[model samples]
Target: MAGVAVAAIPDDIAETHKGIVQLFSSTDDQRSVRESGQAIAALDESTKARHLEMQQSIKELTGVTNRMLDELNDRKSNLLDPTTKRELLAQKSRAEDNIRRMQEDNASLQNQVGALSNKATDLTTSEQQIKQREINEVKRAKHTISLYANISSIKWDYSSPNVKGWITAGAASTGRMRAFEMERGSHSDFQVVNHLWNLMDSV
Candidate 1:
């Protein structure tokens, strides 16, 4: 058996495969993925800190409100001065207002945290999809390479004495005489053409 000139893969396909490999294997893509993870971690930490701070503020305000209530209750049986009572009531109202404002701030903070969390989730999903696409492209490149390798590895028996007889028989059986002729015409090397003819005849 003799080897024939192998057809190379098309330029466009080769370029596409090269591009896919470069895009997935590049350091930039890796760095971007890492950055996304770091950003998510930072967001989580910020959210936790905000939550803890809000809780602490609410706790302190609640304590002050409770103290004022206790004082009001203690003075209820006594002849409390009107000014002192009004002052205590005003202080209580201010504390309650501060608590209400803090609660609203906490609610807004939670919404921001949720939005950041959703963004992180979307980033993660997009990264996974990109990885999947890279995997698929690699598979396609390998398959194309394998297919071309198989096509290029085809061998023919050019030196065999029975080649002509086999070709006639193959043509009669397969009705592919025209295809054989075209293949023969495509080759510049006479030996390669003979080998191809022999190979086709045997097929």
Candidate 2:
């Protein structure tokens, strides 16, 4: 037995198939994606605005050049004298120079904007680090307070040689008084206490 051949789909069926493929597409999803992209674009709106302004300026320069050419063409039709034609050409040359200067200024403005954006990012990072440090300091203070409260309940042996060091250690740990001896430049818990004592004594 021979197998039947397959036939090509008609144009109407193909068009209907294309419509069916898009039938399940969600407008809400497309709108959400577009809004997300626009939010990202808004973050760089300042830079985009500057670039747009520069582009507009270049467009204006082009317009000026075209107008000058049109004016020259009109003057040629009027059969103006050579002196007047020379003056118009000089004006055109000045307009060209202005365009070049505007382009250079645009480049400079872009560089300045980049520098400012970088500086802002650096400052933001620094601010966050400072805030984290402050939060850590507060947490440390609270921990010290809880530790002291628990340790104060204990009846320490003042007669024991090994336990005698607890006097200074306990004072430093509780943040009540500073330790007398320095411990290098480590800035550890005990070392900070020693530094505070040094500052007080110096004053």
Candidate 3:
């Protein structure tokens, strides 16, 4: 027991305790450094993910731009000049207006054609009516001439000249309207042409 207590807590005891405290401080510092390294690695991973998202956004924007360019090219090919898209629009508007005017003109022409057809029909009807009246008049005169041939009569002296057109040689009155008689002499002043025309009209 004297040997054990003789050093009375030997000088190395304090030195040993100091060594242990330094060891624990060094271990805690190392653990802090390792956690900081892990946090830095995580930050690097997040940065890479954000960069990938930005690249995808750029790709989508480029696709939209390419589509717009293609549409512009298609419209450009249908025109004569590429520098005048507005001019092309104006020309298209003018063409539409001209088409509308042509349609109106076609309608007017159709109406005129219909009117002309109606006028032609009216003229034809009137001509037919006049022709029927003229035919009836001619028929009446023919009947008068036939009746005059059936009878022998003495007629008064005619005052008109040149009755030969209505009076034939040896003519006779065959009806009440007949005025000429059988007269072969050229000295007869015959004007039965007027009387025959009047009789035909009356008949």
Candidate 4:
């Protein structure tokens, strides 16, 4: 098949070109859409990475806050100088403020993650739909190719009585032969006529 030019017969060349162009053009469109989907997928990956980093940061901050609280509790329980007690209270206040800020940052990042998740889900659904459409288009294109490839091989079933008459009198001379054979009383002749009739009716 390499280097062979497959020229459609002149009779159908124009229509064939039109069909092929239309069919393949969608593939280009699908490729473009897929590129967009890939970008979105990349974004989703980055968003996930950022989410993980934020979660780790929040965990570390929580650990720091817990240790600071424990130290503050210990300081409160022990008898200490007034100056030391005030210093410990100040340290506790600062720790609580840092914990509050960390909690706020975590909440904000969680919201962002939620939004990103929704965006990712939407992109995934769109990508799937696009892929499905591409699949359907390819199937249709293949069917069109098969139809054209086997154009001469197409089974033209004549359903109209007029068309059936043509089959009996003209193209399908086998039907007329079957009619002639019917006089011999072989049931097979009847079957042949019936088969032809079925073919006619199947149109």
Candidate 5:
């Protein structure tokens, strides 16, 4: 309002302006504090958000790890289905590896959060709502082990052209959905590699 008043008045009256605009103007020192505070707040918010994401991912992957361990224990009891048995073993390997990686990721995020918290000035209470929202979303998504649903549509034949055989791709992209075993990662590319290594020995 003060700026508008100054602009609205004619230049001839500019020097004679007696309104509080000229008197109440903010100092350069105060403006610096306001802008710097805003910037710090934003950076703090983003850093916390990132830390929260890493924690959630780690938590989910830990659950996945434990599930894989249970599955391996079950397999030790009996190999009810030989085909599925081999696939399960492969998945177990991947899950164990993923869990280890997630642990490291979790630690890294925690370190970052601690460092940033020390630098931030009285902003600890900020973004509590955002952190809770992220936690809920991550928990819901990570509740289950991720498996490719389209593998059912794929058929594996002994004399297929490629070592890993061919896949119909299902709804996934032509190069994506693979016919390989579940032990392969969610994407078929890694599964195809597993097939080459395992199928030869199985046959």
Candidate 6:
């Protein structure tokens, strides 16, 4: 039966078996990782641009406020009538109000920039976490594939029909098989077991 089953495998399938294994072993998270990196970079660029824009706005507003204060000082020092002095006082009050409003706006912009920076930091951290998870998953997959390869290499001597003898022959072999079984059963998603079964079925 085993010989017949082996014979039943198509030549094309046997030829491509290694390719199929490679396909299954390839990490699916690579594209996600790349996309996450790109997103993070774009976000960082956007944050930087916004910060620069805020800084420019603050600089320009400060220059305008300074010029207004200088003009007020010059007017206060000049010889002026009562009506002109009252107008100067009103102008000063308006300028003070404008400066206070600009200060509030500057503070708000600073807060917004801070929030954007924090958000970018969070995204970067999340990306790093995702990469770490992918690395761990790849390691697990490699270990599982190695275990499967070891299990497949064990020869069964059906002619003598000594299952217990075969199992007991090597402690290392038994340990590896037990470890493989335990690993297979420990998956929460059952995806690893299903993947292994699929690989076996294809073989």
Whole-model lDDT values for every prediction: 0.60, 0.59, 0.59, 0.58, 0.55, 0.60
Q: Positional deviation of 138 in candidate 1, in angstroms?
A: 0.5
Candidates 1 and 4, the one with greater TM-score: 1
Deviation (Å) of 194 in candidate 4: 41
User: Considering TM-score, where higher is better, how would the candidates rank from best to worst?
Assistant: 6, 3, 2, 1, 4, 5
- For model 2 the TM-score comes to 0.37
lDDT of 6: 0.60
Q: Score candidate 6 by TM-score against the native.
A: 0.39
Go through the candidates in order and give the C-alpha RMSD of each one to the true structure.
46.5, 32.7, 24.1, 46.2, 43.4, 49.2
For the record, the alpha-carbon RMSD of candidate 2 to the native fold, in angstroms, is 32.7
Model 1 misplaced stretches (Cα beyond 4 Å) = 1-79, 151-203
Report the number of the highest-TM-score candidate.
6
Error of 2 at 189 (Å): 12
Question: Which residue pairs show collisions in model 2?
Answer: none
Residue-pair clashes per candidate, as listed?
1, 0, 3, 0, 0, 0
Candidate no. 4 TM-score: 0.34
Q: Which residue pairs in candidate 6 have backbone atoms (N, alpha carbon, C) closer than 3 angstroms, thus clashing?
A: none
**Per-residue lDDT tens digits of candidate 2, residues 1-203?**
12223344469855764554355344447665566556545744665676667667777787888899999998787667777778889999999999999999999999999999999999999999999997898579446634643654223343553211222334445444322333332345554444444444442
Worst 10 residues of 4 by lDDT: 177-186
**How does candidate 1 score on lDDT?**
0.60
Instruction: Report how far off residue 43 is in candidate 5 (Å).
Output: 1.2
> What is the TM-score of candidate 1?
0.35
Backbone clash pairs in model 5 (N, Cα, C under 3 Å; residues 3+ apart or in different chains), count: 0
Q: Model 2 shows how many backbone clashes? A: 0
Model 4: runs farther than 4 Å from truth? Answer: 1-82, 152-203
Residue runs of model 2 more than 4 Å from their true location after superposition: 1-80, 152-203
Write model 6 residue lDDT over 77-125, tens digit each, in one string.
7636687788889999999999999999999999999999999999999
Candidate 5 lDDT by residue in tens digits, 64-104: 88899999988876688787889989999999999999999
